[model samples]
Structures are given as C-alpha cells and as structure tokens.
Target: MTQPPATPLPPPRERRRLRESKSLSQAQVAERVGVTRETVRSWEAGRSTPKGRKRTAYATFLASVEAEHAPAGTVAPPSLNSRSAGRHGSAPLTRSVEFVQPPVRTAEPVNCPHPTRPPKTAAEAFDRLYTHTAPALVRQTYLLTGRRTLARESVERAFQLAWQRWPEVAVDRDPAGWVRAAAHEYAMSPWHRLRPSHRRPEAPPADAADRALLDVLLSLPPAYRRTLLLYDGIGLGLPETAAETEATTPAAANRLLHAREAVAEKLPVLAKPERLHERLAELAGAEKLQAPKSTLVRTDGERRTRFWTRSAIAFTVLIIGTTALTLRTAPTRYEPVPAPGAVISGVPPQMGPGPLSQADKKLRATLRGSGRGGPHRLAPEAG
Candidate 1:
C-alpha cells in the first residue's frame, strides 16, 4: 500500500518574514493559528518548530503573503534570506506599521448568526437536523417517559441511530419522523425495567388539576400516552401521530380514545376538549426545560466498523463462557475398583462377563447362597 506524503513545515526565519510582510502583529497571527502568542513567538524566534496542520497553515499563509506584498516590475526573492548586496536589501526601506485599535464592547450583547446555507454533505445535514430537531425530540421523549435523563438518553440514542443510517436518513421524506420513532422505541424499551429507576417517579405539574391529570396520563400504557402527546399536546394529526409511533391511523385513533377515557375516569374536567388540551399542554410543556443539546453521530462506515468489532468481542466472550461452563458442569467419570479381599495376590480383577454357561452360572448362584456358612468344600460329597 502507498502512503500519502506528509505536509512540509516552513523554516523558522520564513515564518518571521511572513508575519512582517503582512504587517500583522504576533497576537493576530496567534489567533489565526489557534494558539497562544507565546507559541507563535517561539516558532518565529527559532526556539520551537511548528508541526502538523499548524506547520502547513504557516507555510500556506506565508506563500499568500509573499504573493500579495511582492513589488511590481520586480520578481520576488525565491527565499527570505537570499539578500546579499541586493538592491532593496542595500537600501534602507522603511515600512510603516499601523496599529488599528477599536473600542471594547464588553457590555454589549453578542448575536451569533446561524448558518443559512444549504448543506452540501450528509454530515452537514445530520448536524443541521440535530440542531433543529433535538429539542422537540427530547421533549417528546420526556412526555412519554416522564423522566428527564431517560428522555435525553432516548433522544441521543435515536440521533446515534440516525447517524449510522445517514445515507438513508438524509434522503428520507420524513427524517424527523424516523428519529422520533426511534426515540419513542428507546423511551419504552424493556431494558429500562432491568435497571433500577434513578429518575423521578413523575414530573411535577403546574397546578392541582394538571397534577391529577398528569398522574392519570402516566398511568396509561406507553402507546396511549405517546398517542395523546402527539395528537393533542403537540397538535399533530392522527396520521402524523401514527407515522411517528409506527402504528396505523385507526390504531392511533383507538389509543387516543382509550387514553382520553382513562384520563376522564380520574378527572372529569379532562372530558372537555378545551380543558384536556390545556392540561396536556401544561404536562408536555413542563418538559421543555429538560430538552438536551443534540449530539454527533458516527458515520455509516464507522458504525459498520464498530459493529464488526463488537461482534468479534462478543463471539470470543461466548466461546470463553461456553468452555468455562462446560468445565464446571461436566460430569466426572470414575473407574470401578474391586473389594479389598476380592483380588487374589498377583491376580488382576475380573472385569469381563462371568459364568456364561448354565453349569458355571448354577455354581456361582450356589456360592452366593452360602453367605452364613463357611466357604464350600471343592469336593462333591452328596453329588
């Protein structure tokens, strides 16, 4: 495999010349280079060398400065120190350095403008989507789970999934809807049951009526709760709610109906549409403060790499676990030993089938019946 060439660093003397040619202060150069003024001074003073991207930027900047400051009708010097008895070098040329200072506006508020340009890449699109949709997704998740941390976790996981599938997600007709569905799934996951609940049992409401209504709403099933939130709290239609929850329109409507009935049983005030919307708004709006900042997601290729790495690790662990368990639980085999006196001196214990013939079997049976008598004499007395 071939390796790419590394970027070249500018000579120390060349760096000082570039700063001077541009009439830029060390502070300005430091800011542009994203380093401290002392670092830039060290580079220019030959005490240290610029490396990596910093060195490349220094070289590129110097080239541009030379191009801009070169005098007309005269070719610029190929190198900064190539001046021995040169015309301009011999002459005492003085250049005026202007120090432009502006009044400090520390007391004034700063307005950061958002980028309005269209995204040209999938990464840019993902960033834009995170910035715009993170708040709403978090709030929606909070409304479903009634837990701030869980809501943030769900939204983050959803965005992570979106990032892994950015190729599909970036081109989807309803990217936000796709993310919302993921968040909802995460918020209602059974995995949460395995973990001890560290979050608040329920969110505090704005008023008594809202509190009672919220208690009842949280008691309902996750699907019904989400349906109510999307349909009424956020003012989304049944079709959109169904799409977000991955349910049919009729299913969403049925859930909405049941959710309303459940709420009405606790607080009759919720039976009224206006009252219900008001309470729902209050319940959902309480979560606005808890919406978390959007997170960056790994790209599709990176996700694939991680997936394979995790799979390999899991397989190795599985093999190790199987071997350990087998070793621990396998039955042990024991060889049979003869009785202490059963073996005669210098004779091996008989392990084969014994007394196969009728006469031998009858003789063995007679010996077994002589348990209380002395060993039978070999001589046949009565027979």
Candidate 2:
C-alpha cells in the first residue's frame, strides 16, 4: 500500500535562507566562531555584524560549523602586522631636516684685572662686613684718610684687586686682614686714581653738625687721619697698624697722636680718653658697605654674533633693494613744456602760479589808479 504523502517540512525563514545559501547555522556558526548562542541569534536577527578573527575564519569551518552550527568565510586569516600595515601606509619622511638648537653651558666669573675695578661690589661687601665687625673697616678707612670719598674709593679698589688674586690670597692666613691691609696701602699709594670719567661721585649732603665734622676730618692731613683711624678707630696694634699704613711703628704712633689732637681741638673739653676713642669708633662705624654684583666681560663669540647679525640684516636689505631696482622693467622720462594759447600769458601755467597773471595785475593797477584819481593822496597826519 502507498504511504500517505510525507509531511512537508515548513520552509526555513530568511535568516535560515541566508544561512543555507552561505551554508551556515545559528548553532554551527556560533560554535565555529566561538561566540555564544545569543550572539548568533542576534546576528541572524540582523542585530549585528559578526566581527574580528572569527569572522575571517567563519568560512573555513563551514562544514564543521554546520555540524556544530557556526559562521563562514572564504578569505585566509589576517595577521596583526598586515592589518596594522593596511590601516597606515608604509611611507617614509619627505625631507632631510636639520634643526639648530642651543646647548646649556656653565657660567664663568670674570676677573676685574685692574685694582681700580668698580668698587661697587666690594663696597657692598664692606657694608655687610661693617655691620658685623666690632670696628667697621669702611668707616675706619674714611676716618684714617680724612677723606671719606677717597677712603671708599681706595677700599673698593683694593678688594677688587684681592678678589682677582683669590687663588693666591685664598690660602692666606687672614684673607680679611690681607684685604684690610691692601686697602690701607691703596689709600696711601701715589697710584690712587680717580673713578671712571663716565661715573662721578655724588656730592655728600652737608647738615650743620655733619658739615662741621666733615670739615674737621678734611682739615687734617691724610697721614694723620690714616694713623688715627688704623690705630685708634680700628683698634689695630702698633706693628699691625704700621704694616697696613706703610709706616714704621713709631711713625704710626706719632700720626695717631696728631689725629687725636686735631680732633680734640674741634670738640668740647672732655678729659676722658673714652670720649675720643668712642668718637673715632662712631665715625668708623657709620661708613657704607655695598653688596657685590656680577660685572660684564668682553667675549669674542658674543662680539662676532652681535656684529654679524646686525651687518647681515643691513646687507640683506641693501641687496634686496638693489636687486629690485635692477630688475625693474620700466623707466621714467620728463616731458617738454607746451606753449600757451593766444598771445600767451607772461608765465606759463605749468611753470606755476604767479601774481594771478601780469596782465591781470596790470589791469587791477589801472582800475585802482582810476578809482583813486591819483593813487591815494597821502592822508593828512593825525594831529
């Protein structure tokens, strides 16, 4: 007997149609692609595209994937390097570039060769030292010399000289003492020079008492003031004071005596020695000390750079202008003047304006004469 027609299976949905066309299935493709069943469900439902290596390998495992349900692909697997190379082209730089960059360098201090180098720094140092020392060296120098200006000038000169020789003086037993001695020598030396012409000392302000004291100090000779300040103001011993001022011990003592006597003459009668030494100390204490500062030194490279940069800019501009002028294609010419119409005005208009015109001026003169009868009879002088 013929069996009843076998039950026809219902056609697969579009997803199944595509899967059949590509020979894939939800389970098989999912298994082949190593994705979850839910992911395959989403793909079949058109929710997402299959991604990554599994998509590339999808086709390879079609048969196994069909048995187990998986994705399909025909292309060979893509390597990581190949993928990267494909994303960004394998190209080289277009030009050979050279960049000029500056390098960092350690700073070097410049030496002020002359003993008379700017005392501004030493003066500052003296100011600092003056505050700390029992007897300020700066003040003592001024008091000793009876010339505050000279004293400041001398000490600063000495310090600059000594600083330059720091290597030699560095190992000295007493650097500060050496500097002090050098200052004294500088003060008394015939070589003592004036400051640069470019820089002049400002005049000291003179109040009454200060004026009187300054007059007294200035009145004494340099020698007497030097001895007094070095011996008494500075409280230096006889031999040390003598050594500083370039005088013998006895000579230093004599000058010291003279300094005191000179000062005493200007003061009220006070028998106590404290009165004199204290006054001397005060003078020594009041002097100024300036702080040190860096000074400029000449350098060949700096000079060359400065010179060439300025010259190069000027030369470049000049060359460009010359080239532009040479390259100009047109030339200018002056045109000749034209004669005027009719008999012609006396002056050509092109020659520029003149008293309206000679003819016009002459006509105006005739009209004025005719209006006045005779030019104007001189007006009678007012009584």
Candidate 3:
C-alpha cells in the first residue's frame, strides 16, 4: 500500500502562533526539527517553507503541539492516520489536526481587506514613522557614538535621507530598520572624527556602572560594538542583527561573542547576556537623547531638497551659458605667426677720420683738392 500523503502544514502565522502557545522558542523548535534557528525563523516569517521530510516533521510537530493546547470541546480536524483509521472502520484519531487551510489558487484576482488604513499622504506616513522610531533610534545611536549631538544629527540625517527616497522607503519591509541602519552608519562614520566639534569626547553617563559599561562598549571595535548594540542593546535576533550589520551569521556571532567577552572582562556583573541587555537598556534610558520633531525633519529635508534643486538648475544654466559664449567667441580658422627679425650675416665697419692711417690722410687731401671741380667734371661727363 502507498504511504499517506504528508500532512499539510499550517499557515506561517498559525505555525508561529502554535509554537508560541506551546511556549517554544525558535531554537527549541529548530532543535526538535533538526534545523538551524534561522531556518525556523524563516519558516515562521514566510520567507521560505520546508519541503520533503522536513515539511512532514514540522507539520507533525505543530499538529501535536496544537492538539496538546487546543480547547477540550473544540472539534479537531482529521489527520492522515485518522483518515486511515476511519477508512478501516476503526475509531477516529482524537488529536486535533485543524491547520488553517492554505489560500485556494484562483484564476481571477481577489482583493483582501487590509488590516489597517493606508496613510493619507506621504508626509503623514513619513511623520508617523519618524515619530514612532526616532526617539528609540536616537538613544540607540547615542549608544553607538557616545555623543548625544552626533546621535541626534545622525537620526535626523537618516530621516532626511529616507524622506528624500520616500518611495523606496515606503515599500521597505522594515522602514524603521532602514533608517536605523542609516543612522548607525552615520554615527559610526570615521569622517566624524575629523569634525572639530566631534574631536573631543562626550561626557560619560552619570552613574558609575553606566559610565563603565559605556566605556567598555566604546572600547570594542566598531563592528563588534555595533553587533553588540543591535543584538543585546536592541534585542534583535542573531539573523536580523547579522543582516543589519551586513555580515555573515557566523561572523556576526563571532563579533557578538568577542564583544560580550570584552564587556564581561571589564564588568563581571554583566557577564550574563540578559544582565547585559538590562544594563544597556538602563543606560540608554538614563540619557536625555531626544529626536527633533518630525515636522522639523520633514521641512528640513524639503528645504534641503529645494536648495539642491535650485543649485543644480543654476549650475546647469551657468554651464550652458558658458559653453554658448565659448562657441560664439572662439576663432574658427588657424592663423600663421610672423617670423622674428634676424641680424645681417656680414657688414663693413665705418672708421673715424682721426683714426685713419696715412692712406686715409692722402685720400682725404686728394678728395679736398678735387672736390671743387668734382661736381663740374661730373656734370660735363654727364652731358
């Protein structure tokens, strides 16, 4: 006889719900399913689905979990074994297999209702995102840079960039995350070191423990520091932290490990991950890092855009005018240059009468004697 078709898995959301209802962590589920935690996360996130044996195993695990926690009076859906038993006139299996049916394939499109209303305008949507995300982002940036001014600047700049590219930002899976990454990159930029204002260090937190913690955090390499903040300070998953920091999962893990080790070495009290998370939260909360108003940010971004737009237009116009002028005035023909004057190769030198020799004296006397008749003789000769 052929084996029954593998039991169909529930929807991703339902899969996550069932796992959570059973008080299971992704790691625990992954351990049971012989996959990595990231794989389990992906399954729940709807990024990818399991296939073959993994699919059957995952379905079985979720089904058993649902059966255990399901209400007493609720009717359960039939499973493969249950269907088999019923075919043989045996008692139906009691376990609930009521996985939500997957959406039916259809030739025509269907318009499912959205859970929330869309924002009225792009500005309104951007403002809502900014208001919701900026405060927390500022604190996180502060933790990264250890400078309140830089943190606020970074967040504002990030939001400005997001607004500049609102279309892209609007469709992003995690807009807040996009802005956060931007802010983090700006705050951690090595260029900030060259700024005169940023040359000096910001004052440490007032509390000794906080100061020590912040010091230790700043002491870690920028990559390690960022990974630690994203993972421990902000409580992002390892995979998400890796993705945000642009590193391989294993590399992110290594950074986190080394960062934690460095912190624990400096502050033994925060050796535990949970304790470190708490301390980080406490440190961030203690600061008065407030983001600028969303309206101000939006307006500033608009103003900046306008300024640049006008500048670009003016620059283009100037370039066009200059090119036209050059074309109009430039000579069309080549002209040959006149050659420079040169001196004669050979010439006789004139001598003064006083410096002349005896021949010169006799020639002068003869010329004086003949001078009176020279004109008359030359005239007769001509006639």
**lDDT: which candidate is best?**
3
Instruction: Highest TM-score: give the candidate number.
Output: 3
Residue by residue across 209-316, what tens digits does model 3's lDDT show? Answer: 889888888899999999888766654566666788999877888898899899999899998876786677678778877677778898999999999999999999
Worst 10 residues of 2 by lDDT: 95-104
Cα deviation of 259, candidate 1, in Å: 1.3
**Candidate 3 — which residues are off by over 4 angstroms?**
1-117, 340-344, 347-383
Which TM-score value belongs to model 3? 0.61
lDDT of 3: 0.71
lDDT by residue (tens digit), candidate 1, 1-383: 99566666556645654564453556788888787877776676567878778877776777776566433211211121212112112112111111111111111111123333456677656665665456555655676776778888888778887887788987776676677778888889978877777533644756776566667877999889988776656445556667778898778878988887888888886786546766654555554444333332344336666988999999999999999999998878876787676546887866888648998889889978886587756786795
True-structure lDDT of candidate 2: 0.47
Backbone collision tally, model 2: 18
Task: Report residue 363 deviation for candidate 1 (angstroms).
Answer: 35
**Predictions in order: lDDT:** 0.62, 0.47, 0.71
- Give the alpha carbon lDDT tens digit for every residue of 111-206 in model 2: 333322333454333322222221234555665455566666656665555555656655565555676777777777655435463155435424
Q: When superposed on Cα atoms, how far off is each prediction in RMSD?
A: 25.1, 41.8, 16.9
CA deviation > 4 Å runs, candidate 2: 1-135, 144-152, 189-207, 269-272, 286-289, 294-383
